[model samples]
Target chain A: MALPDQITFASSPALSRNVVDALRAMIASGAVGEGEHLKESELADALGVSRGPIREAFQQLENEGFIELRRHRGAFVTTLRRRDIEEVYSLRIALEQLAMERAATRITPAILARMNEVLDAMQHVSPDAPASEAVALDLDFHDLVYEAADHDRLMRSWRYIRSQVSFFLQVRNRSHPDFVSVGYAEHRQIRDVLVAGDPGRRPTRSSTTSGDALPAPRRSRERPGLIAASGRRDPA
Target chain B: MALPDQITFASSPALSRNVVDALRAMIASGAVGEGEHLKESELADALGVSRGPIREAFQQLENEGFIELRRHRGAFVTTLRRRDIEEVYSLRIALEQLAMERAATRITPAILARMNEVLDAMQHVSPDAPASEAVALDLDFHDLVYEAADHDRLMRSWRYIRSQVSFFLQVRNRSHPDFVSVGYAEHRQIRDVLVAGDPGRRPTRSSTTSGDALPAPRRSRERPGLIAASGRRDPA
Candidate 1:
């Protein structure tokens, strides 16, 4: 699976961030399952690095909530249970709502054009394309909104959950491969609203309080569907 | 200055969290000024630890946005510019608004009583109390609201900016030592609204769209003043 070049640690001084990104990409691509113990020696042998960098990478991953290092035991991949996903979704909704509200007026024409390009990229992904591809594009699309919003701390808050959000998107992509195309239409609606540039009329608030609610069944299918459907400023 | 024992690193399984807490307290208490270079050897010498723990603490501190680790250079304390303060305040206002709205119905009598206790404690804080004392109580007060909200990721998001928020509060306390009393009244108002417990009528939305705006003059005075006064559920 292709990894994002920008997935970096804040403390990049004199450390091998490559190990960090490689492990993150491995986890994000489902190469390693959740709750699996990552042996330092084994990972060092596998990744062709020494134990020191592996340990450092583990520390970085733990910092990013990607892994848990148990005392006396080795590092274990974090399992995002249903409750964790719900927490991530609810928080993401609040953050994106704020981002969209702020971006409504601040969004530049250039950013809108860039968002159109991301949608176009999604359109090019074939049905057999890797789910990670769709996931990356999906994140890229929202990343643009945060960029346009131009609030640094707001962007940081989004990044704080971006990893979990990526996992959630992976679940969604596996559940619905056709979601990419559907997402195209959903994002188009949001883009049109951004193009309209109506801060007062922006549909930042969800009409129903259940906006954060996830359906009991088909967890992946219905959870993001709410945000993709009614959570944004739907001009309709 | 007394530090909160809860300030910890995610990778605390082996490393000494005392170093992280000590450094954070030093930073938050303004013992270490902004943009000041932190020599690892000196810190290790002063804190009576080896350089290894100090390095580990630097990585953790950088992750929490307390300091910046420059490549080829050492660590430096993060300077919260006016822009950074505005960003922190605006994002915080949004997060707290969401927390209070959700906390309205979910807040238990036990929690309200606890909040009342916090306020009572605030009322007793003498004028000459250490600035960090007020800072800790101020954070403790908001920490309860997040707990009442019962959203894990939301609380994590709060913790993300918490250090800067600490710096911001320290700035406020120094500027207005009497803010503890003023804050008592303000929090009492919010507590009354929570006691009212009407989500339908909760004043979650700002009456004026300028809820996030910081008054240009006397930023330390007016920026938090907005959130402390008009940003929450102000029923009156």
Candidate 2:
């Protein structure tokens, strides 16, 4: 009944998918330290599964850039060198800023209310709360932004980078106690900017541009590059 | 010597990586059309390899979002749905803008000159020239920006999306004649911006910031977020 650390993947059809999720959680929670080689034999033994599933799991995560598998050597939990952090955060700012700019124009009042609720929860979070709790709240808040932006590709890319962001933070043991309050303020600013910029503020303007006439030129900034082209227009 | 359609590993040290590269090339070039079913037996037969490497390579490409693997049904080449194009382009705009904004500040003269060489190649590429040639030149120009930005993770993410970008363009058969001239102009504009924005423009201002007081805060825009936190300062 009490099989701690054993991966009991209930109801999931794919064994490898469940294993990947379990292993990713373990890495994210610091259960398995970074730079530690993941031995198939040991993991297979501990999780009470065959080496086949473990190998497949390794392949899956490796593809996602979460782990690096060496030819002769075993898999290593990817440790974030300082550069990885800087690169990931730089991408994050570009994506989240663009998401906010778009979300601001399209976000519904219901979404804003939900975002405010997240901000309230963040404000009350204790200074000493676990970093995972804070990271979850932070990701959830931004997820709402991406969702509101209504860009499928953008959302997919964000989810991939989201795992990497949490991975590095966990490895470096870098989340500090004072960050809760600071993050709260930063998120609050984001929420305010979204509300202030929402075109739904004037519902008629949004309706004019809401329908399917302008599918290709989704963002105003990107239009100049392609629109100016003499060709490349869809006849539709 | 002409083993048409067969994947020859030859002298490559890593089989799976080479297979992944070859297969990715096939997909990107439209040699393997969208929605095509890739069977391990068939692929391994054609490539003159065993099923093992083919399976691993499929997994690798799947991880990169190039193909979809279904249970018992095998892998299917992902068709570039309209939204995928929109998604890739949206992410591209966010990424290129951030890259240009950063590259403008730090790009070196030699790098700008190399990018100029790419622009020259693009300008000469005839409208009848293959889309592949134009796409390669275009990527090279942007690659220079990513390199100048000097962010490894950013570059990695860019390359992943770059494949999908090329994949869709090739599939739709939509790289019109006017695009050659239009793309040439766009790339030139980008090159000009990079040269103008190099922080190295005013050598004295750059030199003052260069000698090691700051380590992590690479961009002028992102400093306010993490730097204000009480802990988590970069030891570098």
Candidate 3:
């Protein structure tokens, strides 16, 4: 599978970043399964890098919550409990709403034009297109909003969360077809709202709480297990 | 220094987490300076552990964005650029505003009362009474708000950002008189609004075109060079 352009080599001053990106993609793409142990020697050999870079990359990945390192056992890809997923999406809604509010005014005509181009491209792509492609498009659209907000820190946080959520999307996309259209529509509406420069107004109620606003479950599918497990419970 | 009581440590499942917490405290308290390389062997030696747990802790810290690891150079505390601080605060406003909105419904009298108790504690302690104490109270108030919002993911993100901001606050606080009263008043107003459940009904102003509301500079000190160099030219 072709990797998304966004994951291309960043001129990060640190070499370990290159390793981090490689490993992150592997994990996000499900090549590295959830809870799979990450062995330094194996990864180092596979990537043709030294144990130093592998260890450094592991350090970076662990911080991003992509992996968990056990003291003596070693590192493993992180498993998100259902509540963890909900909490992530909920936070995404809050940040995206804020970005949309800021992007409304700041989105230049050029940015809007690019967004429209993405929408048009998405329209023609079959809903059956690889889930990664769909997820990449979704990210590109949101990245534009984040860029417009002019907040680097927010963008970084969003990037981290998006990486985690993309894992879940990979699973969900295998079964769901209509999310592409619904997601595209939400993007279009959000774009329209920004272009119109309406900051104070909430988007029409049709926008679902989930970023995608997927339709209700059909045929006892993956819906309940995923959504129920997405957020946190009260300690009580 | 007394660690906050909110975090309960369980010894059974995750030793890496314990190491992560210990290292985080070290970084947060300024025991580890920015740009200082973290050597696995050295840290292990200091903590009376092996390289395994230290390496595990490094992974956790890296994911949290607290440190950056270079291939052969080892790990160093992540440095914030001026833009990084601005982005952090901007995101804080967005996240905090959402928390405030959610807290409007979830906030209980008991939480409000606890917040008031903390505020009262601040009132009794003069601003001159140790910077650490004042900062503790400040954190307590914000923590209460996060608790009221009842979102664990948001709280975790908030805590991460707050820790980063604290580094800058250390520099800023030295120049400004402790504006404890003003800070408390703002919290009070926010609490009052939440208690009243005022929907903040003012139509969001045209989000697209409006510029940020720049607060009058409370301190005339020049922006830190560290941040100024890193600040992105905002497209807006």
TM-score of each: 0.78, 0.71, 0.67
Q: What DockQ does each candidate score versus the true complex, computed on alpha carbons?
A: 0.48, 0.40, 0.43
**Candidate 2 Cα misplacement greater than 4 A, ranges:** A1-13, A29-32, A63-65, A108-120, A123-129, A167-175, A182-189, A197-236, B1-10, B25-36, B70-73, B108-113, B123-127, B169-175, B182-185, B198-236
lDDT of 2 by residue, A46-110 (tens): 78788878888998787556687787787887764444555666676667655766798889888
lDDT of 1 by residue, A18-115 (tens): 78888988987678866778988777766666787787788788766788877678798776555666677667767877787778889988988999
Higher-lDDT candidate of 1 and 3: 1
Q: Model 2: how far is B13 from its true place, Å?
A: 4.8
For candidate 2, the docking band is: acceptable
State the lDDT of candidate 3 residue by residue for B1-236, as single tens digits: 22232334566656566778788888767677666678777766566667876776776676566887555666887765555555665677667766776677889999999989987887777867656566677677778878998886688678767766555555455555545555566556666766887536332322210111112233455665543343223323
User: What is the lDDT, from 0 to 100, of the residue B204 in candidate 3?
Assistant: 30
Local lDDT at B135 for model 1:
70
Error of 2 at A57 (Å): 3.2
lDDT, model 2, position A228: 31
TM-score of chain A of each: 0.73, 0.71, 0.78
Clashes of each: 1, 4, 17
